[model samples]
Target: LDVPCKVVITAPEGEDPHPRFGKVEMSHAKHRNVSCVSCHHMFDGCGDFQKCADCHIDRDDRSYERGFYKAWHSESEISCRGCHKAMKAKNEQTGPIGCLQGCHEAAQK
Candidate 1:
């Protein structure tokens, strides 16, 4: 797969269009060492890649557990912040992991 060097994630539809933290830029290049499915959990080896919001929506029709917010913030490796936290716990070199850092650093107003 010809993965892009970077992938910027924005808030899902029905959420804040201009989010406080702005967009989260993920480094697919840096993550080349990791399996693609690590982040793209729902991707099948031969299927079209999908946007997270395509499945994890922010509609009030479902529980927050299935909502877009949890998809990104959940304490699971499937989540960006969660993966970083897990790596930190293993004493591995990781990027920022603070509420004001990592994927949640406040964006410039």
Candidate 2:
């Protein structure tokens, strides 16, 4: 008789070098609906996500910048989805470009 053993694999805290950073407690229950493939692509995955273009606008080859992550999280250690979730709840609005309806809404607030 042969027995089968199952191994449980857990992802490291945070994606890569950007591990939590000791700012806030990580939320395990949140982000249950989001999938790893939702944010990642063939080349880069969710771990490589950046916020530079998120708040910037490009016009005629010129890009203007607005608030940055530093201002948004205020030096917290929450994940991207965690932050967005709160902003959406606070705003109580939803749409394509709006905050509360997408992955950003689920990020750290």
Candidate 3:
């Protein structure tokens, strides 16, 4: 019910939790003024769990087709960078780091 909540999603032990594990804090300022339905458009019915790459795949014109990686880094309206830049401008202390340290944490090596 609140933004910036710490959501912990876990997988069964020994299962491959490749991308996600441990704990993550939601974007407090990003979703604070919006409703859940804005993003979870299918909340009213049962359907496949939506992944970012599901609708964010690159266009057929060879513009962008790398899947999740491209989508996450894209500066488009739907991508994380779009809002992260704004957040950073508003507050340097709590602003997002695009993908340098946030989602790409594992890739830092």
Q: What is the lDDT of residue 11 in candidate 2?
A: 24
Ranking by TM-score: 1, 3, 2
Which residue ranges in model 3 land beyond 4 Å of their true spot?
1-34, 37-49, 58-67, 92-95
- How well is each residue in 1-109 modelled by candidate 3, as lDDT tens digits? 3233533322234544445423224554555665554444445545544644355444333346454344444555344565566556777444355444664454444
- The model with the greatest TM-score is 1
Lowest-scoring 10 consecutive residues by lDDT in candidate 1? 100-109
In model 3, where is the ten-residue run with the lowest total lDDT? Answer: 2-11
Over 4 Å off in model 2, which ranges?
A: 1-22, 37-109
Clash count list over all predictions: 0, 13, 1
TM value for model 1 = 0.81
Residue pairs clashing in model 1 are: none
- TM-score for all predictions? 0.81, 0.22, 0.43
Per-residue accuracy of model 2 over 83-108 as CA lDDT, tens digit each: 45554667944223333333244333
- Maximum-lDDT candidate: 1
Writing each residue's lDDT as its tens digit, candidate 1 over 7-80 gives 88876655675545687777777787888788889887896789888988665543477687777777888877
